[model samples]
Target: MQEKNFITVDGKRFHYMWLRDNCLCPECRDPNSFQKIYDISEAQSPPKPVSVVEEDDKLTITWQEQPIHQSVFPISWLMAHVNELDTPVQSSRKIILWNKTDLQKERTVRHDFHNCDFDVWVNQLFSLGFTILENIKSTQELESFICSMGPIYETYYGRFIAFIIAMRYTLFFPSSLFPLPSSLFPAPKSLLRSPCSEVPKNQRFVPHGYKTCYIPVKPIKGTEAVDLAYSAVGHPLSPHTDFTYLNLGRLLQFIYCEENNASGGESIVVDGYRVARDFRQNHP
Candidate 1:
């Protein structure tokens, strides 16, 4: 069923003007910047869809506006933002909460890269800040897979893969093919350092021009406190988020486990968003 000036997708109603205003077409938005060039406020009247067609998980709308505007919206995108006009008090996106017991049932968070579809991959990444891609063989395959999602952001260290969404989060791939000697291996760099210089201007140990840091969890014997202070090696790190300044505070990270011979390096993932919601409910 359809309402006047609105189209229904999967039983949810979305206004024609809302859909048109949020159109992601290159003509309406800049491809690189992803900023909207066409202002919805400028329109004399609300957009009207002359024809609506749903096929292959896509909603195509042909607008009745002069010059015959047409736009295609992904069913996934529409479903994700179903409550866009809802009261501002509610959270924008619904999150799935899980504990150790939930994790035992089946692998819901991780997906095999070879078998995953584009829509499924996008949904998982969007809903969860992190997703583990299994069975990725080589760097070439990783590059190809990331490029399919969106444009690659090349940095001083390596290519940074970023997706276009509310936040522009970047993915970094560190190569293990060319293993360097312990003496020659570069130290972990600080994200605050300037991109122009190799060393920070303050004469700190922090290295610059590197977007990603490689931390080897393998056990190492006997190291000076000075060296250990500056390095991520042999150091136990508590759970933390990265680079809140960039990409709207939500960074999508992918951790591919190429090899796992060492012990005591188990990964832990906690749904911070879910925890916050629970806390608010209990307290208030």
Candidate 2:
């Protein structure tokens, strides 16, 4: 790697562009929101720092072109953002793709939620696509915990219903793993089905308060679901993701299972990405 026109924080080296773009000064970024106001595209050429100085836990930079433009960044911030670099980056987290063989051979032991690190727990979820956690006391506790990470979004399903959350697990597989905390959601009043619950015919399942799109349960005479879209006898929809119809490329479905009651409608898992790759390479 080129050493010139670069700043090294702790042991990691960052390029001139990285320094210019991450200027923490009020002129470049909003002090309250911390959102960047400085446009990196404003620089036609690579940014050249006239002087780079490290004092206390902060690194300050002065650019020759702007003269007034100075960037002060905490060393701690630099370390945390080491991933945003021009060179090859290494992360402790890894993504491992699995097939049915691993599903049968491997098992996940539930982690104690009260004593677990959220950062490490999330890393594990991404690493293997799913993890089961235990000891989350109640719906209020779970909602509070989830809200800490980000805001809660209510769509076709309202805020944290037991039924919709449960159905999301069985229908969406081979994506991000959302293992239900051992003590999850309120005891479900309805089934874990879209339309998973008792609803009027043709009005698919929408949570109690949500007014959303509905899928016609009854098939059109000429149009039939070929690749396994339904559970009606004889259709036998194949193992596929339900989100495809919604045009979703990737989504994380978190289902907190209090318990499984209904029998026979088991979730069938399929490695869609692997299947697509195999089909392309072998067939073509």
Candidate 3:
């Protein structure tokens, strides 16, 4: 049977342990296996008061570390180390806060953005996380954008609500741990070729002559989707990420069809990376 104990520090029972040995710091854990030690030390204690809350079977801990450190821990992990603790241990959680002023400025930019100012919008995307290019001349322009760089590839995961090829351009972006967040939109269906009998009747679409196309990362098991082209009529596309494979430094590329008979659907891009970085710079 599993046993549990409370850790007392500074005359307060924290119901947990604190030791360099018991610390779950990433450096102390095995990268391959992701397991750590449970040793608690006597010299360890937080300089400031830390708060703990117990709800049902889960434990929520709050510390001086603001946004990042505040998290819920499983009661089981707490019980495993509480028995041998003597003092408060340093938590690796770093608190982060969103900058309200910058956020407001960004909102103003979004509200003030005009379709005529494509260059300004592009620069904004470079400063932000992603960019949108409206008034695309034709499907050829969309194709050209996706095919601008070498060694690019499109993917088909069959998960799209409306069947369209999703191009996955992995080459563009820096390999930074801290980078700008970004996202993109699919092209129009007029650019792809038909997906013959190899695709299901309901799932089949005309492929848009995209070479080196592959499958997108699985949003669901046993399913596949790719970037072809999106329809222009009332395609209310919200902001979205492509895959978890992406790192921090990434640029979002979006092209919207601006032809006649187009109902409604303005392109919208965001700069989540800039938002985070600005927040960190201003707050930190």
Candidate 4:
């Protein structure tokens, strides 16, 4: 046994103890057992104190026992299990900004039945509040690029998705610097007339000829899935129940990508059921 250094999540320093005598994995405990408790004691032989290192939102503990021992856990875990520790401390940067409006928008957009590419649509709204890019070039090059898109990533409707012109630029830029030009993406006069000017001009852009549709889990390699495109940004998307409006039921996520001269934007998706299952379990 060795003296161990424990750093409370709130930055306080002290010794630590776990109120458990034996480490029990699920296999070691009865599956139906309601709960288990263990006793704690001071180390039999006090050696050098352990060191705690904080890195990238995680805390690592290292101690010099007869055999060196180390473990790492998220800083949030200490805050969550504060009561189990002898002393509780608060973290300096535990505060998170929950954009309620953004959450509401997420719920609404995911459920919207309209035929608009979800990523393009969300990016447009985020950019200008709302936009309508019109008179797009619909160039042969753009068409060729769309053709190059393989069926691996196509939407449920099997249409390739992208902006009208060939050039790739920022859609989320300030209105003052509209990325895509109207010469290539001209807005419809009717749609422009009704648009909320509150939206930044730069935010609006027309989608290529591709129509919006549901994004399936199946990889349409070389094809782009719009919804999966933006959701890949690593945000916590809420759990959605069945859809009442359309028999389409519920979707897991969406995916999309832009080709030609771009790198490092590969798609990633996590299983919702696995996330839910892990959230409900406590381990040894």
Candidate 5:
């Protein structure tokens, strides 16, 4: 039986496999990462759309197979990619950057907490990288509001990360023996430890409107050197985790070096839940 592609937006009909492959739904694509979980070639059979409907400038397609799935594509997305869809692969679109004036213009936006369109907030976050949200009642409210967008990706932090500031201000401190910033200064009860920084920056964020001065600690011999080259090339390097911003999370995978010239620490996979269970049984 021949299936016709009735999904049309902006006078452009998207290919079946392309639409299926680029499915923005949480199942086919990771809600957090935005990576495609659905692969076109390895599919058991070609993507066959049995039903297509267009509403509110979105095309929804239901596949003609078991383990039912649907793909939704926005009209704007289809219109922008009309030409690119025909190509083998397409380059990523450049990010939209803004200046201080652009941010000041947004200040006029009245944040009505009760009647909120989180979709607009999500769009603002995607385009501007960061959008200010205030007057959220509690962590529960925040979680519920956030989950309205997609599935929750549980963070490894001891508590919830309700707020995250995007801008990175790298501060170089002279102290070599400092503990990891998050562990050192814990976030107050519920809120996240603001500005999770990379290991390179040995300092926390100092907000503007405060005049501050720093006196560098005297360098001691046999201490870790603050050099990017040293971190990359130095053998038997200091103990540290990769992607420190992630803070020892469950997800990220360890990769083998492409050119294995020198040996690095073994990549250990530990089941966090299992470890916690054993610890509780033994200790309690």
Candidate 6:
């Protein structure tokens, strides 16, 4: 057995363990069942490849051991796992930064849900950090649309939470002044008088275990005397990405606007990656 756990096959290097695990022979893998018959731990030492040959995309390897004397691999399968084998494949699509002129030229970025293809939608999202999707009639339709792409990534905030000031009036009272009921302390529905008895089941936006908090952007009539933080006074929120510490980072943040009567709540987006690139180029 060779100490080096790699072998060059058809000009591509593959791990010995990876090659051994993917053995397609009838002894290693059941012909009818297709399940692996050989246990990975059964190999006492690294199985070394003594001979390797390629014919018409098929790769054959002769090992220097018994019970798993030979193995065959397809070139296509080997190429597909090139990244896993520590080979980097360059991507064709480059990230493009947009200016005001670029935004004007690409004004028709909004895709209609009824008419858009999945690949087109995904491509647009990949190219641009965010995209506008119009004509999504209801919440159910939006949920269904997202579910089609993949599972909804529930975070510390849970699946979804809509911030409506009126619904969370009870939360404004200090816990010292008005101690919260044990049932109403943690859950979003605790703020409600009757836990969504009035709203229809389907229309209920906040799912169970979802956390909710409401901050008034505009000052209420009586609360004008109390000085508040800049955020409470409708100041521009500092641009930031959410949940970067978590695995994969927050996948996406969806904002649904029901109404926009108040001022100074406009959305701002900046490509952090593009900014870093520009900074490095200029500074260096």
Q: Pick the candidate with the highest lDDT.
A: 2
lDDT of 6 by residue, 109-208 (tens): 6888789876766766667667888776644565566666567665444454443322212211110000100011112233344544343211222333
Query: Cα deviation of 177 in candidate 6 (Å)?
Result: 34
In candidate 1, stretches whose alpha carbon ends up further than 4 angstroms from where it belongs are: 1-94, 101-107, 154-157, 160-235, 245-251
| Candidate 5 worst ten-residue window by lDDT | 172-181
Q: How does each model score on TM-score?
A: 0.41, 0.40, 0.33, 0.21, 0.32, 0.46
Model 4 weakest lDDT span, ten residues long: 173-182
Worst 10 residues of 1 by lDDT: 176-185
| Cα RMSD (angstroms) for every candidate in the order listed | 18.8, 17.6, 15.0, 20.2, 22.3, 20.3
Q: Of the candidates numbered 2 and 4, which has the greater lDDT value?
A: 2
Worst 10 residues of 3 by lDDT: 169-178
In lDDT terms, how accurate is model 4?
Answer: 0.33
Clashes of each: 0, 5, 31, 18, 0, 0
lDDT (Cα, tens digit) per residue for candidate 2, span 1-284:
23576677777887787788778886775454344557776676668777788889988888867455788889898887786525644667775566767656654525787988777778767666667678766545656676676555444435554322123122211111122211113333334345544444443333332233444444321123222222222223234343333433234555554554323335455566566566558644
lDDT of 1 by residue, 192-275 (tens): 235622432223332222233333222222132232212223343334443322333223344433432233335678777676
Which pairs in model 1 have colliding backbones? none
Please give the ranking of all candidate structures by TM-score, highest first, separated by commas. Answer: 6, 1, 2, 3, 5, 4
Q: Which regions of candidate 4 fall more than 4 Å away from where they truly are?
A: 1-8, 12-14, 18-42, 46-48, 84-284
Could you arrange the candidates by lDDT from highest to lowest?
Answer: 2, 6, 1, 5, 3, 4
Tell me the spans in candidate 5 whose CA falls farther than 4 Å from its real position: 1-6, 84-284
C-alpha positional error of residue 101 in candidate 3 after TM-score superposition, expressed in Å: 10
In model 2, how large is the Cα lDDT of residue 124? 63
Among all candidates shown, the one with the greatest TM-score: 6
Clashing residue pairs in candidate 6 are none
lDDT of 3 by residue, 156-252 (tens): 3221112332122111100001112212333343433344323221222332333324334322111121221132211133443444554333433
